[model samples]
Target: MAETVSHHLGKGRLVAVEGSLQISKSEKDGRTYTNPQVIANEVRFLDWPKDSKKGNGQSAGYDDDNFDVPF
Candidate 1:
């Protein structure tokens, strides 16, 4: 299955995702346990990219020549 999300990204906008794997420790009843997990450290909106869209008239790697898209 597929899902859709709507967001406003103008000509100049930045987006980023950062994640890492680390060990997590927990204590229960004077006993300690360790678990490893993958974590998303940050999602940063730093700066705009010179080109987020790919080459040619199509944006997001879709062919815009065939159909007219209203945006």
Candidate 2:
């Protein structure tokens, strides 16, 4: 399932996470609870700040002209 969390989503980047819900039963209270666990599968950068000097010195925004493809 694809779920979006406020803390995980941000500007200039995209995050793809995969995981499943974990169900556990407590021995003390005999109560059942569900927890969500996720792992990052892939990350693709969509944009960045123009003045930001970070990550290979690439500027912000989408630029397809300079994009390189490997066969």
Candidate 3:
């Protein structure tokens, strides 16, 4: 399932996270719950851009916003 999702990312930077939902029964309510458990060693990063800092890396028209940020 993860492979199919990454393939659709189309050469973009993709992070592969391998894990499974651990189903457990709650003793208090007898309800089943799914908890995500990520395998620390299985995480991967793929397809980084050639230039990390391309085109100033800023959103257009954001530099000239007229709103006062009263900290």
Model 3 clashes, total count: 0
**Candidate models: Cα lDDT each:** 0.46, 0.41, 0.41
Whole-model lDDT for model 2 versus the true structure?
0.41
TM-score for candidate 3: 0.30
List runs of model 1 lying over 4 Å from the truth.
1-19, 40-71
Residue pairs with clashing backbones, model 3: none
Error of 3 at 51 (Å): 10
Q: Each candidate: how many clashes?
A: 0, 1, 0
User: C-alpha displacement of 60 in model 3, angstroms?
Assistant: 21
Report the lDDT of model 2 for residue 9.
38
Worst 10 residues of 2 by lDDT: 1-10
lDDT of 3 at 43: 43
Worst 10 residues of 3 by lDDT: 62-71
Off by over 4 Å in 2: 1-13, 16-33, 54-71
